[model samples]
Target: MSSKNSFYSIAHQVNKPENISKVLPYYSGLEIDIAYSASKKQWVVAHHDFNNTKHYSLEDWLTSFKQLYSKRKSKLSILWLDIKTLDDNNIKDMLSTINKHIPKNISIIYDLGRPLNIINKNFSYKNIINNLREIDGIGCWITKEDLNLVSKVKNQLITDKVKNTIISYGEVVDIDLEVLYKLCEINKNLQSPFSKVFVWNIQYIEEIDELIAWQEISGMIIGYKKQMWNDRCLDQLKYLNDLKVKFNRNTPTTF
Candidate 1:
């Protein structure tokens, strides 16, 4: 079966490890950025801008997250380990360090900012596809035109590779009813559940209602203002759960 058929598999990306224990139960997965310091020769988890403040060193990240990371083999969620500004050797070395010290099922997805327009156009995807064989996930920025092109590329890719052997995916679509409808249409055509949607900063509980009005996606993202975690991200999870239930309702009563 295709992998694009689920709904609002909401994900969260942040540097604060304190939030991980608090938020993981409510999320599908986590998106963490790893910054490799040329001078220090270290890979650390740092998400925000300026000086790349260390939330957790690579060891700290794996040590603290061993429980969560180890389980990816049995239950995969989007564990996006974004390595910033590294040459080929450094990237591999960092992953090696992670495996040695932090030993988890990692999928080093190159978060392509432009994917089609720039970040990954010709050889970028192939580079990762060829070099980063251990990577199990992918995320690309979305535009309608790009969406069409990527869907075609994804279709061609899976045709050659072994299914379920890897977790390659993309869901870079505009967040609108029309766009979601198109995504649904694509989901219907491809017959797969979505693996990730990288949009962030969700405020207004009502917007959650809007995005999942007719969809129940699993494995995606939701950036939240401070407001989202006021009650331990409970309100947001409630909203997502409602959507999940809506989708479940359809599973047994499809026309």
Candidate 2:
């Protein structure tokens, strides 16, 4: 809705929690592997394996950012609540907390591996697509982690998943041209299902952006390695924006 974008939602991988402001001007949003807590009730944005940053918790990171989120308006755009290693028991509590912490429409991306149960979720993948039942939506992530998952969807009863899930793909993964084409085709046909094409977290920012842009990915999930920021990511996004404008008239929105 805002024509605005979030650039490098990062993890507290290697940087300090406070330096986010220093580099905030460089990109749109923060996407981290983990979340940190600045205080008992507040959260800070961080993402590192587990050992590197002891204090890194999503809650603390956000708590820190809340103080300056408005001031660093243009630099950061989105926040990533990646649960690469989470359990079923935590889903409800985590989702509830995130729903409260994250600003509306800021884009919170969860791992495909995570078992999802939205508002009316029967929590069954099968029940999700009962047609008569359609509960909520699902996550479509494409990364080194999700690429295979996306590829497998065609083989799987993915249409069923798509029917009930808000699909998004591409996040910090390596992608291929052929894969992109097939994905685009799937996405094109899936528009009726309103299945979204998520392409924003690929590490090879420019490698396949052209491929990404040619397709009408439902919504993009911008990524960042706070360590590298947009030195590479920004260049790719800029190219994507330029190409979009150039072909604004003649470009086909589907594969």
Pick by lDDT: which candidate is best?
Answer: 1
- Residue-wise C-alpha lDDT for candidate 1, range 160-237, written one tens digit per residue: 351222122233222454554565466546644334443443543345544554443333455554322234455666
Estimate, for each residue in 1-255, the C-alpha lDDT of model 2 and write its tens digit.
Answer: 222121122332323456566545643444455432323232333443343445545555555666666665443444544544342333444455555555543444443442232222434333323422132334534433443344345334454444433344442454454555565665455425334454555455454445444535433444453353434555655654565555441222111
- Report, for every candidate in turn, its global Cα lDDT versus the true structure: 0.48, 0.43
Which stretches of model 2 miss by more than 4 angstroms? 1-16, 22-29, 35-48, 51-55, 75-77, 114-138, 142-173, 200-209, 212-215, 218-232, 235-237, 248-255
Instruction: List, in order, the clash count of every candidate structure.
Output: 20, 50
RMSD of 1: 6.1
Root-mean-square deviation of every model: 6.1, 7.5
C-alpha lDDT of residue 82 in model 1? 52
Report the poorest 10 consecutive residues by lDDT, candidate 2: 1-10
What does candidate 2 score on TM?
0.57
TM-score of each: 0.65, 0.57
